[model samples]
Target chain A: MNEMIRSLENKPGLSTVGGIDCDLHPASPATKTLLPYLEEYWRETFVMRGVDRLSLAMTSSPSRAPINVRSDWKAESGFAGDTLEAVRTQALDPFGTRLAICNVLHGSMIMHSDDMAAALCGAVNEWLAREWLDREPRLRGSIIVSAQNSDLAVAEIEKRAADHRFVQVLILAQNDEPLGRRRYWPIYEAAARNKLPLCIHAGGSNRHAPTATGWPSYFVESYVAQASIFESQLLSLVAEGVFHKVPDLKVVFAESGFTWLPSFFWRADKTWRGVRAETPWLTEQPSDIVKRHVRFTLHPVDAPDQDALARTLEHIDCDDILLFSTDYPHAQFDGLNALPAAFGETLAKKILIDNPLATYPRIAADFQKEVAK
Target chain B: MNQAVLEKEKNAEAKLGIVDCDIHPAFGTPNELAKFLPQRWRDHLADYGQRSANPLVGTLPYPRMTPGNGMRRDAWPPNGGPPASDLAYLQEQLLDPLGIEYGILQPLAAGSSTLNQDLGAAMCAAVNDWQLDKWTGPEPRLKASISVAQEDAAAAIAEIEARIGDRSFVQIAIPPRTIEPAGRRRYWPIYEAAEHYDMPIGMHSAAFGWHTNSGAGWLNFYIEEHYAFSHSLQSVVTSMVFEGVFERFPKLKLIVVEGGFAWAAPLMWRLDKQWERMRSEVPHVKRPPSEYIRENVWFTTQPIEEPENNRHLLDTLRWVGADRLMFSTDYPHWDFDDPRYAFKVPLSPTERQQIFRENAKQVYRLP
Candidate 1:
């Protein structure tokens, strides 16, 4: 491990920052997570595509995705601790320095039948309470909510803002509004008030790149399809002045390639100058706001093209805004070591430890203190 | 033939010993393949060999992408600029430039495009003949994978019999998209024919359409569909494992072309785990899925970028072992990788030799 780290330019001291997506299904606290329908259902779909959120594999499964929010999320699956440990052993502990971002599934869709959004909120809070908070200072998890039920989602954030364990609010990005709409304001307001970053992830169990159409054939094709999602989402958020309203709220474009982050900023800023009159509320160009607020994580790094990412940052005028990530364990994700391997030790140190520390200063200060000891 | 002379001169590089695994031969040009194929199967193939399915996807008003539904165009045969007619130039530029010792020409069209198995036999005959007289036959270093149509066992076997005499042929290639296992009892005739010819079976992926023009109307666009070939291989392996394909034909070997090695370990574990409870599904198998893969199956590496260090690459190589895998360039595809880079990997000189040349020669039993 030391030798590997050395090759990765071991820049001394342990820093608590990193994240990987885990494969744990949300088990009902009342009984076993047998997945009795797992085999009988779209067994082929399960193996090929780890997506079954909408149960598209199961024709019997419903079609619509509601932006649902839980009213009373409270039950615990009793598996959070084990799941974290596995993420560590199988992924984080092996490669990353200290802790990992645990991207969990909040039931399947955004909306629910019975305060479904609230149930997920309470469940997320319970998991944090049992597994993270104080017990594991290094642990950071996303507070999952639905786009369908924004009001209830705000309520859930208000309820749990004091808990540091719930670090970010995660919502699947395929929604009715192009990501930057006023409809997302209430949720942004709540998140800013609570000191939480908002993360928009692509589809997995739920619809991610379901897009205006459907999934693509190759990883390249799928990634290309999502390039627009990031741009459009950024444009929507900035255009609607969600950032201006929720000044303190951080927007993390997690798991998308950071190589394009810089370009998106430049292009948005360029477009806003010519088109800012369409919405005259903003004090600055779209690029300036996003560069100040947006952070990106690297997953599908184009191995042959490493320098391109760094170059893009220079072009977009925001190298400091960039954050390194290893979207671990999913079908298209790389292992934790990928960050270190791809960017050598110096950049890896900055990407893994320093940049994240800078973004969430409280977490960084605590981490720096830990490494000092 | 003299290793002593070649060894003394290191600069006399062997174009880094590139062994192309997923090389394609033109199945149909908009103008020509129709000429060679029986009129019955030609139209269907012509539809698929067009652009990789229509872009406007869905079950709505748009015409769904059926296999062979469009005028399928061969990406190779580079659109009439130069007929692969300059055979000697192929040997000099393609062979000498890459320092490629051997190129295995696999059949491009399965049914009509990549999967129609009825024409799987005839397409194989046409490609093999073209590859020999036109491409590799003159360029001795260019070997070929004999394509076979196993939709009908008898016809596939006859195609093999006709070409078995050619030394230029190395392995028999098939599309991984077929619903039937490569080891099905029905395919035994082709397998036996391969063994008689001392050939291994090499499989490459086609869009699921190779089986029929009505390939699975994927909810996924081309992005997901392109890699779906790996799943097809898994289906092929599952079929083979369950139906006693390996046990019945001990000498037969299956080489998964184009699919990367990262997914293989996980697939083996999943198969073994599922088989534990689902043993009733394949009672014919005695050992675990991993064992069968270790014994009879091997995968080729192209855009191999997993496991950062040379040690990681070697560990994966050792897990699957250096012998089972033989490296290939996947030349002319969007994924074409540098063969020289394989040596740059932190592996020892011996591991390098095995991956580059020795192992391939032995696996395909090439001269």
Candidate 2:
């Protein structure tokens, strides 16, 4: 039994050199940090309201939760990715990441007031560009948008589109409504026009319980239920004709574990066959549509062992869907052992370097420009 | 017959007498269910006409894909009644042909956890009585689930108490979509009663509740709505595990019906991983979440996940052990699985017997 368990364990020494990290959560800027980026009136309003003193980080990922910060990665500030230096040395340097995308999980995106959400989201993008992207050559930014108001969200996306450093648009997996509804199509339209892959990360607005049932007592229940949120959004995107409407758009499910994909795809495809009339625009199979337009990041592999991981990947069938990610400083994996040994060399290269470049067009364009230089 | 031929026939007969964990038994007519309801509730049903959490009055919020309310194309009876509503038709279409020796009936129309608590309890009692009177009494091969309004624990417990000694009722049926997550203390009395009565709770995937099908909110299409069934059950399982349901009711067994089982292994892994880091938040959960799931939960396989490669499913079955699976056909539904072809992968004789027959028998405690 001991020998069997040992053999199932992932072998060490799988190097992730030059890998493009697709989902890295840089510490959210405190409301005070964003005051400089916000407009003058809003800035003063924040100070007067005492919001400037608030951390504004997502409650779903409390700083003190051991899952939120690895013991070794935690800094004196009581968080792991609090500063650019911390992110660089702790995440980038260790993984040998060629380029890492920064996803900031600030509470501002989920604010109920559309105007405040938009203002704070815009400030977050600007703060991200100036504070993190401008400082590190290897860093990239995801335009954090308030999904509550698509008009404002699209404006923010358009504002940030000119910056090549910004490669994707970020939104929570759980929002006011399902992301595929026409109410939010303008955001997808803007993302497609700008060639930015929309990254739906795990976390929500608390407009509803994290589960379809009512609220959970423990955070672990909320955390584990994130995968289903991703599933619902994926189905919505396919069923609502988002892919058909915006053919150029790409979707990235970050921190949404990939092991659930196989079963989800099966259920989606099977149900779609019988229910195709309701979704007339879905001319193709749901799984095929997902494979064509969607990509998932690798973190919290969720499989029990190397064999299970390999089997899950095989069930997923498509090799191009997985992009490499560490979900850095969130304690997904220990040390630099981010890529599972089960990925093998060939698949690892696709997940690490090829898939991300293909998913994020700006990154590919930037890499091309760098090569020419 | 020759002695060798007789032996071969005996073995084949034994193997063919498999237990199907999920077989829907619908009412023959609207009056069939009404007959079981108390006259006062019957009058209420006529006046109010079954108020649900869904927005639509008569139709489902998300309409089913297939005709005859998502029934199999051929499931409509020759004499004209809803699919699975006619016992003779059901026997012809599923039980006899599929060799279902013990088919557990899950009545989806119960709406046991609907928002109107009093009406919900009344509907549950009516459905439970209807199941016993119409189905189990006529067909000894068929068994009933004691449907209850789980939100009203006192009423649910009363319903359980009213049916405890009956061998015809094999398990207690609760809707996966409850007013609250099933693990909350408000629902503990029902669990306690289930434990005391030695009845496993069968939480079948349901569509109606106060909550939207998805955690994110109401989805646009039926495909998305159908997909939410698995997610609903996933949350229930997660809620139960983390909230220490198993720790409290150590001997209580849960059989998740209609919801696919392939997601179980991954859910267990995720629960264990989070428990290691966030155990302080749920200290009452004495062991890893996976331990409770392994010890307490049984998964029914219907609408079985058909991956691109069959071997991948075998790997999942291996991870979620063959002992944990029970065969379910979801008969008369559009996405029903044919028992012969449901499992694409090869199973050893022991594994096949366990999944197809013995496991469900043990969980439901059937003769």
For model 2, residues A1-373, the per-residue Cα lDDT tens digits are 2233223244773789999998888887778889899999899999999989988777776766887888899988788898888888888998899999999988989888999999999999999989988999999999999998999999999989999899999999889899889999999999999999999999888788878787888788898998888889988898899999999999999998888888887778777777788888889988999999999998877866787778778888899999999898898776787887998999999999999989999999988998999
In the range B108-187, model 2's lDDT, one tens digit per residue, is: 88458566789889889888888888899999999999999988889999999999889999999998888889898898
Model 1, span A327-369: residue lDDT tens: 4443222222354333445665666666666666446656667
Among these predicted structures, which one has the highest TM-score?
A: 2
- Report the poorest 10 consecutive residues by lDDT, candidate 2 chain A: A1-10
Task: Enumerate clash totals for all models, in the order shown.
Answer: 50, 0
Q: What is the alpha-carbon interface RMSD for each candidate?
A: 14.7, 2.3
lDDT per residue for candidate 1 within B1-367, as digits (tens), equals 2322212313333335656655544433445445556776667655654222234222122222322321122222343422223444445445576667777665554432223445556666666666776567567776877776656778777777787887788887766654444545767787777766668888776543322211122322222233334445555665566567777777778888766664454345344433442444456777776678888887777645333223334434544567666777665454444465533245555665676677677777776
lDDT of each: 0.52, 0.86
RMSD of each: 13.2, 3.3
Docking quality of model 2: it rates as medium
Give the fraction of reference interface contacts each candidate recovers.
Answer: 0.00, 0.73
